[model samples]
Target chain A: MGYPRLSIAEIREGLRRKQFSCVEITQQHLKRIEEADARLKAFLTVTPESARARAAVLDQALAAGEPLLPLTGVPIAIKDNICTQGVRTTCGSRILSNYVAPYSATAVERLEAAGAVIVGKTNCDEFGMGSSTENSAFGPSRNPFDLERVPGGSSGGSAVAVAAGEAVGAFGSDTGGSVRTPAAFCGVYGLKPTYGRVSRYGLVAYSSSLDTIGPLARSVADLAELLQVIAGHDPRDMTSHGSAPDRYTSGLDAALRNHRVGVPFSLIEEGVEAETRRAIHRALDALERAGCAVEEIALPHLANAIDTYYLIAPCEASSNLARYDGVKYGYRSEHFSNLGEMYQITRAGGFGAEVRRRIMLGTFALSSGYYDAYFLKASKVRTLLIQDFQAAFARVNTILIPTAPTPAFKIGEKTSDPLAMYLTDVFTVPANLVGIPALSVPAGYTPDNLPVAVQLLANQFHEKALLHVAWHLEQAFALKPAALAV
Target chain B: MAITLEEVRHIARLANLQFSEEELQAFIVQFSKILEHIEQLSQVDTQGVEPTYHAVAGKIDRENARSDVIHASFLQEKALMNAPESEEGQFRVPKVIR
Candidate 1:
């Protein structure tokens, strides 16, 4: 093996045996980051000094014979949207480019507490607004599968780092398919946990109601381990659920025999490529052989998911992102003489095109005359969409669909066409809208050598069930660990 | 159903964002396309369904509000230092209505 592409388990085992110190492992990831990140643009900032210092202490603790957590010494990348203490948490916006968070996000705090060394902060869509990382003030992250194409986005950098072997695993927030879409495009495993299952405290809010922080890893087990560490309630966040029961990583090895999996017929949508269809079939066949009862079901309203998501997400985003008036912790205009001038100039200069567009849409939707016609109507539509999912889950234990309509598109393919860009999340958005847990695992690849993923959606608080299905598929469809040759 | 440039400008004003003429024209076209797509949701009949404002299933305990536990972290301290304008340890913004 080139450099021992260590999963979290393997790295933990290696650490236990003292095969490599935490500092050594961290340095290896840092070295890979330095060598690979320039071309990939996967990271916004690499905290080499902090990572080394943290890793050194873990190494010292090991020398003193102290027991370490399972994720100890494992270098992981964090999406820039998630706050890390004393580190710049930009949320991929010029607005907060210099904004350093004094306290870490609850998820980041939990992961670091479990001894996971945060290697760097990865790039993201500005304020997690775009489906593609192209909306970033930073450059778009290149797909590790094909450098010419985008590594799917919003959470593109997190997905790219894990796929490119820069980090064993990483954290990313999913709002409107940010995590799973990029994970699918980059050919990595990503999980969007049930809303309220993971604490959103310290994650710069982007649509508070729909946003979820989750993991992107090379394998299902690694994703599972990362999820276990980060999944819990936080007193700091009122929206966080306290009573949700989870033994997510435990007892998942029963092997998906005699389980029912529903394949949404709407997955074969108008724009789906022929190869993407065949890839889903191949994945289904593997599941069938493994004793899964694969059946074709119709979630008719799923076709409307993208529409409901656009209205509801932007509306929530309009409210959530209103806090960055430039009078707070971020960039402020020096030329503004009056307060209105300050707000106008600072936001205009700080925000990008997509951010501006969403803000406008959201404001319009929530405006006095339009509230009932737009935001309230969209809210009602969201309930219907959730009901559709709840009804579908009643018939099936898991819902199987394509993560993206097709595999990774060219970097600039849909940037000009906003609707085309929005349509990429057609399949992934419904899961987010319903606040159910979902996972994207590499199903197979196109003949053109790009990766396509099959997504599995489970009902609310059904993370364990969703992951069990993903892990089963991961083992069966263990396509020869291929990645772009560095 | 095409969104006009005037509508785009109106929305931009409500958002408190400044848009150039070119941006307004582009957004008029783009938002029109998005609105065209989004109009499909209205076709679905959603009578009697409870609108989901939040994702969580159960009711939050309004009776069980926790006391504010202050962390002496730099985040609180920096919130003050990072304020654009402050007076007597409070953030000062423009007066709401002139």
Candidate 2:
């Protein structure tokens, strides 16, 4: 197998055995990115020079008999929204197209400290705004499974990079299914850690309360490993939890003899496609066979998650995005009569259509005379959704559901219908709203060969349990990682 | 509730944005549809429920105060590196008043 297709564990083992040098693996993966990224359009920036330099350092360390780091010389991609020191951190928008981050995000710093090679920054919806990468200003990333279909987004490029074997793994932020949806569409493993579990110090804010940086990998083990490296408390991010990080890979192989897996059957009945539903049921059945106690559970307020998310995320987004004025950084308009005109022209010209739509929606909800009716009401419903999850977890260890209502749709299918596109996140938003850990693992393939995935969610800070269940399910299914014919 | 064209324009103004006639017309329809979808929350019985502003609200470290001390920060040149126009190590913008 080529270097690009190797898992992080395999690469680590190979490096220790001297089966391959770090430089060789890094070069091979860089070559794969050079060859495959044109058709896949998965990366916004490829750092070949920096990657080689880092790999050379690691190779010298190995020669000197130094202890190897956890992710030594493993090439990975970061979602463009995560800042990389001296790298252009575009959130897939023209506003920051030329913007170079002065500092690295905390997650990037931790990854590099662990000896990981950052090959490039992957594409996303501008500021993590959309369910599909089609909203990306750079252009949407195409699914490796089918070029006609879109890679689900705003983490689409991250998922595509891992699925196409361009990178061993990738990091993407989840604010309402951005990571998991793309992972499901690309047939990779994605984990959204509980809010506050990971530091968001340099992650460009989308929704402060909901955004989380998580991993997308070819295997569940890699997902857990990457999460271990990046999950910790940071003084810079006050919201970061002070609890010690869990050893996520510790119990990965343990049997789920008495584990409780709740299936929210009622939530999937209406909008989910028949094939997707069957795939989820089959996954649950597999879990049952593996000694998991699969049972039906109720999350009655689940139907209200989408509405609550739409209102609250936009409101927070409107506030977070207000920093992009003409003065300090990012884009500025060339012609404007006054300061007020400059602000208007710069923002109007800098942002894309979907971003503008969201900003406006948020502004309306938070505007005078309507804040109580829309934003506050949505917040109350968010509380109700959290309670529903708490109640379900009281009876079950982890909740299981379909990652997305349907598999990846055609590129332009739902772009014209804003509401329809929003509905794509119905199954995944609850985890974000409640600050719980969630994961999406490949379940099976559809008749058309598209990938379908099942989601597992655990209560807040229960990522180890969630990852344990996912690793077991992943092995039980024994599905092969996605390989592109190209 | 159906949003009026005037309301759309007002919201855009509040957001510090401007749209052409064509874009505004399209937004009118899109906003109407999205707002209609969001209207479902009105049926939820949220009576006596407290709003959750932050996902992990009570867990925030409100008392983790640092001592009053000055530390190193970004240099002036680096801070202004991404600005569209800069002079004398300061971002340049249009005058606020006539």
Question: Against the hidden true structure, what lDDT does model 1 obtain?
Answer: 0.85
**What's the distance in Å from true for residue A61, model 1?**
0.6
The per-residue C-alpha lDDT of model 2 at residue A115 equals 94
Off by over 4 Å in 2: A1-3, B62-69
lDDT digits (tens) for residues A1-486 of candidate 1: 253379888888888887889999999999998888889999999999999999999999989999988789999999999999889888899988888887789998898889999999999999898777999997798988788898888999999999888999999999988999999998899999988888988888989889999899988888889999988767777877776558777877787766898887665757777777777787788879878998888777788888888999999988887788877678887877778877888889899989988888888888888787678888888888777777888888998888888888888999999889999898888888888999998887777778888888998888888888887788888787765855
Candidate 2 clashing pairs, residues 3+ apart or interchain: none
DockQ of each: 0.57, 0.78
Alpha carbon lDDT of residue A201, candidate 1?
Answer: 88
Tell me the interface RMSD of every candidate, in Å: 2.4, 1.2
Cα lDDT of all candidates, in order?
A: 0.85, 0.91
Shift in Å, residue A261, candidate 1: 0.6
Candidate 1, superposed: residue stretches over 4 Å from native: A1-4, A266-269, B59-76, B85-98
